[model samples]
Target: MAEALNAPTETANAHAESFLRDACATLDRLRAMRPAFQRPSAGKRIRTAFDLADECLGISVEKEALLLRQALADRQNLAAATSAALLRLAGLEMGYRRTRGYPAVAQSGDWLQNEQFVARNSDLKKWAESALYMSAAPANWTGRIAQALFGLAAGAAMAFAVAAAILANRWFPAESIPWAILIVISYILKDRIKEWLRGGFLRILPKMISDRMRDLIDPKTGRWVGRTREWVEFPAPSAVPAWASPLAAGEFNALRREIPPDDVARYQKDIRIQAARLRRAHSRMNSITEILRLSLDAWRERMDDPCERLRFVEEGRVCEEIANRVYPIGLALRFSEKRQGGRHLIRRGTLFVTRDRIARIVIEPTPEGGIAGGGAAR
Candidate 1:
């Protein structure tokens, strides 16, 4: 009875230790390859990393188990070291996933184009409105009015001076002086003396507004809300500024053309495979952790009371089943058969190991139908 109780606890510990050793070795291998991985460009480095991850996924369970057994037989206490290495690798992979910026090829081209157009038009409208307002009327109406009034007062004062000059001297011609005064009065009321200054101020105002609007626009989508650009004078395509050539020019055209249909298909397939492998790894890690926890609990229970051997053995069997069960290649499977080309027969099904030592497949029912298991059948 004592041997029977101890057997399961010992087996669980050995298995956990073996798995951790193998994981640590894998992490070391990845670390060794880091320099070579970093040699590639950003995009290429991501592709290489995915390829390495795929290779890791392809490693057979039998080989990993054999390696772990050998390492354990050598009597190496590497559990803590292996666990630390595994955690480091996981952290690195997670950081890479977070920071890697792939081109938005999978996104809808029409949507992106629409957003770009909307943004461009919005900016154009704002510029047009600014230009029109600046050209049509002064922005500082009060200042303009004040200046006009000042000019009128000056003109009136000059007129009075000219009349006084005429009255005080016979040399000053009254007819010519009256004509010149009339011209000065007309110029002051029209505010034509300050026309050049207003024009300069208006140009600067539109530019400042344009700079602000450009800052607000999204760099990727170029979309902005409000206003229309029907009247805005957009620059000719050929006259694109050097600074804006990357954005305003057809820069994406070459990139788009470079990515053929076959490459796109291949990329999508690779992404799916990588995603599946990553999810599988994550699930396997969780299962391993649960197995260890269950094993430790059973061990502790056995230590507390010798009579609980049977219960501990039973719990150990459950942990062994969980550890030994092969996780499904794809975590989730969706039914392909559709009703009236609308709803699927089965919504989706996930593969999970039940506590009762059974691989239970739970499927969600489609709105149009009850529960079904046709995903694998299809």
Candidate 2:
């Protein structure tokens, strides 16, 4: 009996060691491929990450085998080893995806397979539980509260408008205008008016919110830093100028004739400034065009029914598509806070989604004394 127990114990230990060794080797291979895997295309990077995930699943199967052996041996060491291996694998997967510019929400679904593996192996259950708890934590309570308040205010405004419309028909207009007609007109006009107000508010809201935030003074120099808002509008693709389009070259040439030869440098500088603005505008337009194209593709795939698709187009859901695109790709907002060696900070209430999409905005300091946005994938 003693010899039989010792034999199984030795076998379990060997299996555990082998499983760990293979897991590490797989991770090493992934790291080795990272350098050559650098690609400009987001789709290609996502595919590569998926391939890495498949390899991870293979490793997990081997881990499961070791877990079974450990259970047979009745050793606590097996659970510890399994937890460490899973955590390490998860860390590597997250790091690899992030480095490749994959959004957290996009990669989040891939973890479901890992979760299933954990479910089969009791050792990893604690890690899964902890992850759930951490994810559920109310880290962005301020954002949540602000969103709730905005919803409530919008509801209240609509209610008041309806009530006022009914009262006007009753008290002032009397029998001239029917209460039903008045209410219907008010409802229709209210949406149009709200759209107009929202457009104007959005134009200035960012600056207003930034002003209310704590001034970001340079930690080293204590100098006041000014905030600059960079607005890049993405109109329809047709609005964008052609790649080789002339940038007021004819006008510039005409102006050159009026300027003295000594002032040619200043004239050229003005032309350069205008040309740069045109280029920036074209770039933003192209980006938005691509984003809309992708979003439309996603929408079409989601709306399979012919009637549903037609309804989407007829209802002018392009605005919703634009919102979805912006939620994921995010709008760029550069600030001068980083110029003076201070961290970039935005007031929590300022960032918001235009539509009902579950997106969280993340701002990271860039190397060029600006901030970059990382929004959750819708």
Candidate 3:
């Protein structure tokens, strides 16, 4: 009887050891995952992941056995990397969707254009707005900062140069002054002139960017989708800018005018409106006919592979770019940002594919551009 009892005790001990061994193996496998724990102190480092075991669920899991698993994960596996990348992307979208406001979250369709409005442009538009722009939103400054600096510097420099010449009495008899202290007067005039010209251009730049971006992305049809040839107000046509050639003077109208849907009364529906529009009427006249004006932009990108990515921002240049880009091949996405007050809002605009890939998108302005509750129109 004693011998039999001892045998059972030994067997029980062996079973316990086997259980412990399996647990250790499982723990080691989890450690190989290289899971990155989310915490306030670690900044925003993204890490790969796997379907955490049930033990890893719940907020406090980080301090639990689940935490133990994450702590042990290996950081360099394909599966783990993919998970981390996805999480990071998802986090970005959440942040953007929040800042872009309710527009991106709108229901499928409503008084405003559908949430997937880009779906309407063309195959190229599709590749652009949806894929390219989305992937490149954080690449650069919006060009607003540099433009602001240049304008301010140009204005200030003119004012100072005038003041310096008058004070030093260098060149051009200072005594010829009608009032002797005319330097101050000229400085004021110079300052005002510089401001007036530069300010107008700056303000118009955003509007231009918005309009051209919309057309390239939307390319619908409307009254305003026609292209205009560059105009030169020549005095007897002696010194016309090269851009003012007769060939450049053609309206070169786009085939379509894309406009946004009017959704102010859309609360009855559960949709958010975008700030833009497109015209669908000009699809056949010419590919450049798109209201979103994407085709033109693509053409321009191809034409000017300029440094720092800041050339040909004007609609005309963008249109030309689109006209030229796709004729060749390969896709190059561009990204930028604009600052307002103390905060910065990054925007990703692109010359991409539309549904059938006709070439561009053009949207119409709804007076208010479908902005709700005092929101600015696109």
Best by lDDT: 2
What is candidate 3's TM-score against the reference?
A: 0.21
Per-residue CA lDDT of candidate 3, range 74-164, in tens? 3221234433433443344334344634233223447365534333223323433442221112212335554765677586758675776
* Model 1 per-residue lDDT tens digits across residues 30-131: 656666666656578575655445333323332344444444434543355443543454544434433543121112468875575456445544543341
Candidate 3, poorest ten consecutive residues by summed lDDT: 262-271
Cα-lDDT of candidate 1? 0.39
Per-residue lDDT tens digits of candidate 2, residues 229-348? Answer: 222233443343332122236776588558752110000000001224333434442221101111334434543233212213546554322223222232332222223344442211
Q: Of 1 and 3, which scores higher on TM-score?
A: 3
Q: Alpha-carbon error at 357 in model 1, in Å?
A: 17
| Clash totals for all candidate models | 0, 0, 98
Can you give the lDDT of residue 20 in candidate 3? 36
lDDT, candidate 2, residue 293? 16
> Which residue pairs does candidate 1 place in steric collision?
none
Model 1 deviation from native, Cα RMSD in Å: 28.7
Candidate achieving higher lDDT, 1 or 2: 2
